[model samples]
Target: MAPEYALNGLFSVKSDVFSFGILVLEVISGLKSKGFYHPNHSQNLIGHAWKLWNEGRPLELIDICLASSCMLSEALRCIHVSLLCVQHHPEDRPNMASVVIMLGSEIALTHPKQPGFFTKMESHEAGNQSSSTNEMSITLLEPR
Candidate 1:
């Protein structure tokens, strides 16, 4: 999950797109961003994925599970779409409607910006903030 608070009460269909992006990366890489820990700069799976992507070697991030079953173009397309959905700027991320279209079409895609929560620390900080907010809002008051 991309920290509930990160959705900032804007949790519409776009929020699902963000989640789908993360899932796609995990599915492709066989690595969960949450569980990832690196000694250098303490980056997570998202950072590593971005790094590989920037290096023009995104194929290095693909999961072994896809070795024989996946088509190269399709796998790369999924990665591209996933990256697009996870761009740090919400406005840069595509809506589900556009995502569906992008996936179905063979047209060239725009370059992806960096994914959200680029570092493990950022992810941890956001998660902590969200947890505290959730704790404070435990009361059940009637809506006006």
Candidate 2:
């Protein structure tokens, strides 16, 4: 979920894009984005991916099941595209159209800026974590 939506109860197309980005990363890693915790780094999935990508070890983000069969280049591309979609500012993210083009071609991608919501588990709560998410989405109708 986008931080703005979580913090301010507002959502837009960019917010859905943010959710889509998380979904892509989850698909690649076979882990839920919201609940993933890295004990060593004290970071969630986005933070973990950002760290791995910056350290030149992005393949670590790929699921072990696909470790041998997945093409490194394709997996890296998906990571890159997903990162772009999760930039901290909605304006910094590519809309869905550019996302489609970026996914389809070998065009050089701009490096992603830091993603939002890099929350960490409290030191005492890191390992004893539960499988629940802090889900906070709401929908309502406004009278026109």
TM-score of 1: 0.73
Candidate 2 C-alpha lDDT tens digits along 68-91: 888889999999999999998899
lDDT of 2: 0.87
Alpha carbon lDDT of each predicted model: 0.78, 0.87
Q: What's the TM-score of every candidate structure?
A: 0.73, 0.86
Give the per-residue lDDT digits (tens) of candidate 1, residues 1-144: 553446575555566788888888899988876657544545677877888899899998898888578888988988999999887767778998998999899989999988887765655543342323354556788989
lDDT of 1: 0.78
* True lDDT of residue 45, candidate 1: 75
